[model samples]
Target: MKRFVLLVVVAGLAGGGYYAYRNQRAGTQQAQASAVSGPRAVPVEVASVETMTVNEEVEALGTLAADESVIIASEIAGRVVALGFKEGERVKAGQDLVKLDTAILDAELKQALADLGLARDTNERLRALVQRGSGTQVALDESTARLASSEARVQLAKAKLAQSTIVAPFSGVVGLRSVGIGDYVSVGKPLIVLTSIDPIKVDFRVPEIYLSRVKVGQPVQVRVDAVPDRTFTGQIFAIDPVVDVNGRAIRLRANVPNGDLALKPGLFARLSITVDQRENAMVIPEMAVVPDGVGKMIYVAENGKARRVAVELGKRLPGKVEVVGGLKPGMQIITAGQMRLRDGSTISVKEKPVQTSQL
Candidate 1:
């Protein structure tokens, strides 16, 4: 009985030792898991806040127009005897474009001159007789009236003769002719279209909210799908004083040089106007900005930790933004891997430091 009792006590002690060993091992494993699951540094890409020239620009759509455009028309009715300019040819101001049959007009002018000469001779004879007191004042007055009437006829006849020739009012390129030689044209007949296109005009509109910021002489950059690879530069020349009631926008016009005539009238254009510019402005990549409530925030790396800072943004460029406030030059701002970051969270940069120029 004593031997059996000692064995039972020894088994109890062994069971207690086993339970203690299992508890110790569990506690060690839990501690090791806690150590392994501790918070780790987040990997991110960072870029330095830089200072450079930045432009505050406004974008708008526009249509190109010729500097001057008009439709050539005849003022008198006659048969076209000659065409001075070929289709699509450039002509100078005062260059003749068409000549009408002037035979009838020339004959009328000759008759008017003959009558004028006869009236003048009679008026001289009447004046000499009146001075000698041999002619009545009434007779002299009648001759004087005839002479004035004849002179007026001659002036009218000369004007009609001159109108038989159609001339270019301004230097421009002519479109297809509406009437060919030997085609009879009437008064106010449409002949052709003339366009002056060397320095083209661009018509665009912007929201009225930008009216205060825009001004004459502001630089504008123009692009068109037709000329995809080239950009045209121009200056603002006109602005409408009244805002458009239907669209709540203001109209503006710019003049751009097209020396090579590559830009055509009526082409759709995209324009960017640089209303303002800042030199040595603080700039950073747009990816660094984070929306926080109604304001904006950015994660800045300082001393191996991230600091969420509220920033005031200025102008925005392609993949870049102007930091008007809340940042200084040479400060590193998080560009990527910001989703897992919190204020005061540790960070490990995954890439080399980025610069604004590199973006």
Candidate 2:
């Protein structure tokens, strides 16, 4: 009986020892994981904040338009007898572009000239008789009035004759011809679309904060994707009086000389206006900026750790943002791996600094 009791006691003690050993192993594993993850050095990309000059530029999406864009239309009702020019032809002001049937107009003009001659002969004979006291003054005056009326009819006929031919009002490129030969057109009928592309107008908006920086007749720089290799120079042509309620932005227009005609109307353009350019401005890569709830925040490397701090941002350059406040020269900011960081996260920065290229 004693031997059996001793064996049972020994088995119970062995089981308890095994359970305690397993528990200690689990505790040690949890401690190792916690130590590795807690405030440990993490690999990250970083940038430095330095002082220099920055040009305050107002940026917005730009729309291309034409200063003189219109669709040419006919004023008088007539049949299209001829189309003088082909599509995409360069037309000059006063150049005839379309010709209508003028058979009826020519006949009317001839008749008007004959009526004027008959009235003038009658007026001359009456004036001579009145001077000789053979004709009454009233009759002479009535004849003179009749001749004047005939002269007006002749002028009206000439105007109608001019209307038979359609001419361009301004120099422009003619668009697709809406009318063809032998087509009957009514008054105000569209014949073709003409657009003056030279010195094209580029419309863009400026935020109200920089409204005072823009004005009429100011020079600006313009860039377009279609003409990637070229930078076009332009001048500000207009500024809106009212700010857009929703966006709080003011509309502006720039006149770009499209001498090569490389830039077409309706093509999108990215425009930059140099409002204020400083010779030396402090700037940092845009990626270093972390957005907080109210404004922007950034992580500065200090003693091999990331110290997040609030900053006041200013004008943004190619790939950098001008730090107006809360940072000084020679300060390092985490560029990459900023999202997985805290106020005092240990950072293992790469040996080589990141190179910031054109943005």
The candidate that achieves the highest TM-score relative to the unseen native structure: 1
List the global CA lDDT of all models: 0.94, 0.87
Against the true structure, candidate 2 has what lDDT?
0.87
For candidate 1, report its TM-score: 0.84
Residue pairs with clashing backbones, model 1? none
Per-residue lDDT tens digits for candidate 2, residues 15-108, read 9999999999999999999988785687888777778867666656798897797888887778889887889978889888998898888898
Backbone clash total, candidate 1: 0
TM-score of each prediction: 0.84, 0.66
True-structure RMSD, every candidate: 4.5, 8.5
lDDT of residue 275 for candidate 1? 82
The parts of candidate 1 lying over 4 Å away from their true place are 1-45, 336-338, 346-359
Q: What is the per-residue lDDT of model 1 for residues 4-98, given as tens digits with 9 covering 90 to 100?
A: 99999999999999999999999999999989987688999998998999888899999999999999899889999999998988899999999
lDDT of 1: 0.94
